[model samples]
Structures are given as structure tokens and as C-alpha cells.
Target: MTIRIGWIGCGRHATWMLMPQLARSGFEIVAVCDRDEAAAHAAARQFGATEVYGDYAEMIASARIDAVGMAVGPEVHYRATLAAIARGLPVFMEKPPGATAAQAEELMRASEAAKVPVTVGFMKRYSTGNRMAKRILDGDAFGPVLGIHGSYMTAPTYFAGEVDYTGFYLHHCVHYMDLIPWFAGAEFADVQLRKSVPGPGRMLLHMNFACENGVIGNVIMGTVQSRGTPMEFVQVMGDQNRVEVENVINLAWHRNPPFKAEDPQATLDPGCDTLVWTPNFTAAANEDHKGYHALLLDVAAALEGRASPAPVIRDGWLAMRRLERMIALIEG
Candidate 1:
């Protein structure tokens, strides 16, 4: 059976990424809805959606959609998702499920009560590099995990618009915040955040977290980085090995004795290398190109009743709790 999907918030994100992949993924784009009628109509025209609505409620009430993809902003996510769940629709929501912890929890309870599956767009967890990282961690190839360090830096063009620095932690960092626990196979016990000095069009955040496995996580995020900087990089260190995912595309792993000597003449082996690694770019053509296909695969499994979605309702709640702590620290 084909999955009839309806999309709410047909903005640039939907147009540029999700919409283009829907057809090929065995999903039928049955309806499009947006607050802006022109945007909705344009999306409908481009995707051959059978219907368009300026109001999501009207679209949800009329369409025979099996699943709904919500691309609305953070402020509207709670209401939109609650509405969809009340109508018994499975939902795929954009990241940072809500603007506050209470809202995310409420949605979790509602989805549970309604027996609807809800997936947060924490797509990084579905990436090939992340999968391999998980495998290595689980297999103890990394030995007993020590700690993790990650950085997410993007140029101003990616900021979309002006942003309040404190809010950026909740809006953006939640993605990595959510994944840290997953990657470590642990839970976050506490979190503290520090912000950069007051500035215009620039922001930086430092996050310190205590994990369940007795490991510490230090995450650095900045919106004031050089334009040429890579988008995202993650380094996970363990007792015996370490893995680095750079720019969300390339992954490199090192086992034992982390650094290699620079000069060949100075090294005992002469032609020896310090880091033994391999690069894989198997899925570089797809939208976002990192774990886009894996996300679709998980969605398909969930739709087929073969498996449950990752970063499900519970994951969203957990992530929100972490965000709440960060917000409290920022507010204080």
C-alpha cells in the first residue's frame, strides 16, 4: 500500500529537500498546506499534490493522508503536531520539536495516548558514519568510551535570519544534544551552557554534559565562524580508538596511539603513518547526502509495521529536557 503523505509548511526547506525525495521514496504527496497560499499552491503545482490548504486543520480534516510531514517553525510545532496526533496521523516533525520542554512532553503524552508514531527529524542519527560509530562503540572496538567532543559551525548564510543567541541552543544544538546520548549509549545526567559576549549576527555556545556511562561531553557551536569553515564535525574518543566525522560527509577512524609523527625521517618506520583511516562517500548524491536515505528507510519500516522510528516521541522528550536545562543555565 502506498503511503499518502501530506505536508504542512511548504517553505524553502520543504521545497529544497523533503519534497523532491517523496515521490521516489514510495510516498504520494496528496496535499500541501502553508499559511502562505502562494507557497502552498506552488508546492502543490510542483509536486502534483491533489489538494492545497492555507490552514493545516482544513487539510488534515479533508485529506486521506496516512502520514504528515511538518516543516513548520519551532513555535508552531506543538500545536501542529498535537492537531495531527488528535486526528490519528503518524507525523514526521522537523527538529527542535518545540520551543519549550513542557510543550515537547505534552506532545509525547498525546502521541502515546493516541497510539500514533511520531518521529523527530534528528536525521544525523541515521547517517552511515553514525551507524558505524554505534557499531564500533557497541563492539568495544573503541574500548571503554572515555569522552566526546563535537563542533557544529556554519557560516552566516546558513543562519537564515537574525537569531537570539540563547535560543539558538534550543533551536539548533538540540540535534547534537540529542545524538550525544545516543552515540554514547547513555543518558545525560546534567548540562551547563555558556554563551559568548553580546554581539550582532554572531553567536557561540559551549555545552558541558555528564553522561550515564560516566563519560563527559563537550560540545561547541558557533554561528560566527569563518565562511569557509566546515558545517559539522564530531569526534568520539574511547579507551582504544577514536572516530571523527567531518563536514557530515567524511568519516575517519583511528585505533590506539592517536597521533602520527609528521616527519618520516624522524619516525622509526620511516614511511610509517600515525592515523590509519578510510573514506567512504557512498550516498553523496541524495538531498543532504549524509543520512537522508537511512531516514527514509526507517520511515518506510515504520510505515510497514516492521520497526519503530528512531528519535521517537520519547527521544524528543529527552532532548527537550536537555534543552530545558541549557535554557535554565542561559536564563540564570
Candidate 2:
């Protein structure tokens, strides 16, 4: 069954990232909506959407879409989601579901009451490297976890026109921030921002978090580094082994076998093998690249009961809360 989708915002985000992926996802986008009539018409034509609406309410109420894909700004997410969920339409909302955790909580509660599932878009959770790392780490193949350290730094070219790197992180970096506790299958028990400062292309922040799983973690993030390629790394150290997700392309596992120095020249010991995986580039499918389309595919399956919806409202709320707290420390 095809899930007919109604897109609520057709700005540059929709044009560049969302529309291309949506067109490739195989789901039907029946309608496009935006306050700007020209943007709506362009998006509708580009994505094969048959209908265009300048009013979001009219689009949601009459487009007959199975789900709403919200690509709008954060300020309107709360009320817009409430209105959609009230009408029994499942929604796939962009991350940082709301500007504040309070707003997310309210939307969560409303969705709960309406029995409508909400999927938050944190596409990094769908990245090939991220998935492989989480799979191996969750299996505990390396024994109990010791700690986690992660950093996301690079250019803020995507949202650069709207805000700089630091501002972008505060608003949208949840794409990766939410994955911290997610991989542990735990929630954040406590968090403290050790440092938050500004610099040229250096929206710098350092944070420490205690997870419910009894693991301590630290994250260092910045966008003020360089206009060069973006850099991201997440590493988890286990009892005697470790796994590292390097950027969006590689998953490396450094292993330690139980051999106790059996040979002096064990330079080729298989026990200490460092395994690496990189998804091959293929044009057959958009989801093959571990892109945002995977998230949409998952959302479609989940809405149809074929699988579970993840990075849901709770995760979005937690991510937003953590970011807000970190920002509070710096702004206050």
C-alpha cells in the first residue's frame, strides 16, 4: 500500500534535501503546502505532487494524505502537529520537533491522546555507518561498555544562510545528538555543559552526560571549524574493544582477542583485527546510501505496522532538552 504524503513546507530544505528524497522514496506525495504560493507550486511540480495549498490547515484537512511530512520552522511545529494529530493523521516531523522541550512535550501528550504515531526525522540515525556501529555495539560483542566520546564539527553550509554553525547546532544538530543515548538503549540521567563559546566558524560546545545505563559520555561539537568537508566521529570503548563510526562513510571496530601474547611477532594476529565497512555507491536506490530516504521508508513501514517507529517524539524531546540546556549555560 502506498502512503500518500502531504508536505507542509516547501522551502529550500524541501527543495534540496526533502523533495529529492521523497521523490525517490516511492511514497506518493499528493500535496505540497507553503505560505509562499510560488514555492508551493514549484515543489508540487518538481515532486509530482498534484495539489498545492497556501494554507497548511486546508492542505491537511482536505489533501486526503495518509501522513503529514512537516518541513516547516520550529516555532509552528507544536500547534501544527497538534492540529494534524487531532484529525487522526500520522505525522513525520522534522527534528528539533519544537524550539523548546516544553512544546515537544505538549505535542507528545496530544499525540498520545489522539493515538497517532509521530516520527521525528533524525536522518543520521539511518546512516549506514551509524547503523552498523549501533548494531555491533548493542550486541555487546566487545563486552561491557567503558565510555563514549563523540564530536561533530564542520561547515554549516546547509543552514548557513539562516544561521551560523553554533546557531545551527542549537537548532538542528539533534540529527546526531539524539543518537548518543539511543545507541545505549538508555535515557540521559544527567548532563552538564562544560564549555560553550563562540568563534569564527567555531560554534564550540563541550558536554558531559550520564546515561541511565551507567555509562558516562562526552560530546564536543562545533561548526566554526572550517568550510572544508564536514567531520563527525562517534566512538564507544568496551571492556577491551572499541567501535568507531567515522563520519558518514566508515564503521571501524578495533578488537582484542583473548590471546595472551602467545607469540612475540604476532604482528598479523587476527584477534586484534581492525574491521572496516563502507557502503558501496549504488544508483539503484536512494535508501541504499543510508540517506534521509531510509528514514522515510522506515516511517512508511512503521505507520503500516511493518516495523517500529524510532527517534520518535520522546527522543526529539530529549535531544531538544539537552541542546537547550547546553545553550542556556552559554547564553545565561
Candidate 3:
């Protein structure tokens, strides 16, 4: 019983990331679409999709797919997602959510109005290591969180061009931006940003903020990151314990630390333990990263009523508001 999927935006992301996962997941690719006809045809051919479309509305109105995966950029995310929602099917949309708070809110309202499930593409939340870390942090062992420190850096070249695209932080950092408070189960309450413009399309930001739940946060971002650098980590310090997820897929959780005290009597209480998790890619499949395949699988479950849609539309709106707040603090 393969779920039939209709995919919009057959560009780099769909071609390079989403399509392969959809194909490998055993979901029927009913239709592939893009503004570029050739790209749509190419995706259909590569992914064994039976239909192709140059227009998103036509694809939605015409295809018989059970779900839609939209990888369009932030600029048109609102419109594309609206179309998918109106079609009354579950949807998976790429992140940064909508460009504005109004757009994000509208998406949430529309999803609610139509009773269709929609999840944003904050795929980091679905990563194996992040999941493990979240489970531990959610347990009683980690207790109440004290502070969360997260850092994400990527080349602005990722966005390069496109009208009204807010540089790197607003455009690409939403994944971690969404994950910060998410790990702590809180909402962003305040933010302070000190930004330095390095050059065109490049910025460095140092931010400190707090969640409504009284969890403090610090984040550092750079748009000129090296091509291969994986400078991303989220460190959460709790009641005498700590967990950090690195590069989205590696995590280290530390519990109990032996104090190098001048008094050796503390040795009796010594219990220093560190546990690490890394993806064993030895026989890894598309589901290894928990991004592509995992998301699609989750979407299928959500549409089938087996489980609730995760990182739902409400999450997207919240993340967008956070990104917008950061942009305001910086641009002002």
C-alpha cells in the first residue's frame, strides 16, 4: 500500500534530496512539477513519476496523489503551500516557513480551516542524533534546562540570488532557529543581536536571548563559512548534565564530572560519563539522516491517521516569528 506523492519544485533540492527519498521510500510518485518543463520531465523520468506539470495549481488540481512535497524557496513558499493545502492533502514544505508573520499565520489558519496536516522542512529535528538527544533531554535525568547554546554557519552562496530573500540567518538558519526552543519545549521571549557586515551578502551575528520558559540561549552565525565546514552544534546544559548535538548527526551527552578539586575527598562522588552517537553509514540508506526518508514516512503516517503530523504548521509559524525577530534586531 504505497502512498502516492505529488511533488512540486523539481529543482536542486527536489532533484538532489527529496526525489531520491520519495523514490526509495516505496511511495508512488504520481506527479512531478516545476516552472521549468524540462526539469519536471527530468524528475518524473528519474523518479518514475507518471505525470509532469509546469504549473503547480494544474498539478494539484489534476494529480491523484495522496500527499504533496513542496521544496520551493522562501519567497514563494506561502503561495505554493497555500495551493497544496487547498488541495486537501497532507503537505511537507521547506522551511523558514513563510517570509512574514502574516504569511506564516495565514498558512496555519488555512491548514486548520481545511483540516489538512502540514509540516515544515526543519529536517534537523528529524535527525537520528537530535532525536536521541531530545529523548534524553526530555527524560528526568536531564531535568530543567539552564541554557542552550546553538551555532549554525553556512555560505550565503546558498541563497546567492532571488528577490527579497533575507540573507543567511532568516533564510537558512530556521532549522536550528526552530530547534533551539524546541529542544527546551519553550517559546522565544527576547533576543539581542550584534551584527557585523563583513561584505556583500555576508554577515556575522552574535546573539543572546531567552525562552519564555526561562531557558537562556546564545547563538553564533557566519555567512562566509567554508564550503565543507560543518560548524553547527546545540549544547544544552541542565541540572548537572549536558547534551550537545554536533553537525546535526553527532551527539555527546555528559553526565557527572569529577571535579579537579584541591580536596581529594570528592573522589568518592566521582562519576564522569560521556556517551556519543554517530550514524553508522556502513549500510545506511536514505533514512539514515532522518531527513528525507524519515520525513516522508512520517507524512505518510500522518495522512493515514497512524500518527499526528510532526513539526506541524504551528511550529513553522513559531519558527518564522523567531527568524523575523532576529532579522528585526539585526537590520534595525
Give the candidate number with the greatest TM-score. 3
Clash tally for model 1: 1
lDDT of 3 by residue, 256-291 (tens): 865556766654432466777787787655345756
Question: Candidate 3, overall lDDT?
Answer: 0.79
Backbone collision tally, model 2: 2
Higher-TM-score candidate among 1 and 2?
2
Question: lDDT (0-100) at residue 92 of candidate 1?
Answer: 80
Candidate 1 residue-wise lDDT, 1-332, digit = tens: 67899999999977877777767666889999999999999999999998898888888778988888878887777788888888888888877788778888998999888888888878788776676667767783457777888888654444456655545666567888788888777887777788884566576778888887798878887677885867777888886577787766566776644244675555433232234333444656444445655676677556555675556867888888887777677669
Q: What are the clash counts of all predictions, listed in order?
A: 1, 2, 0
Order of models, best TM-score first = 3, 2, 1
Query: lDDT for each of the candidates?
Result: 0.76, 0.76, 0.79
lDDT of 2 by residue, 73-179 (tens): 78767777887888898888887788778998888888778778888888788888887787787684777776889888755454544554444764546665687
How would you order the candidates by lDDT, starting with the best? 3, 2, 1
Task: Give the winner by lDDT.
Answer: 3
> Each model's TM-score, in the order given?
0.87, 0.88, 0.90
Q: How far is candidate 1 from the true structure (C-alpha RMSD, Å)?
A: 3.8
- For all the candidates, what are their Cα RMSDs to the real structure? 3.8, 3.1, 3.1
Model 3 — TM-score against the truth? 0.90
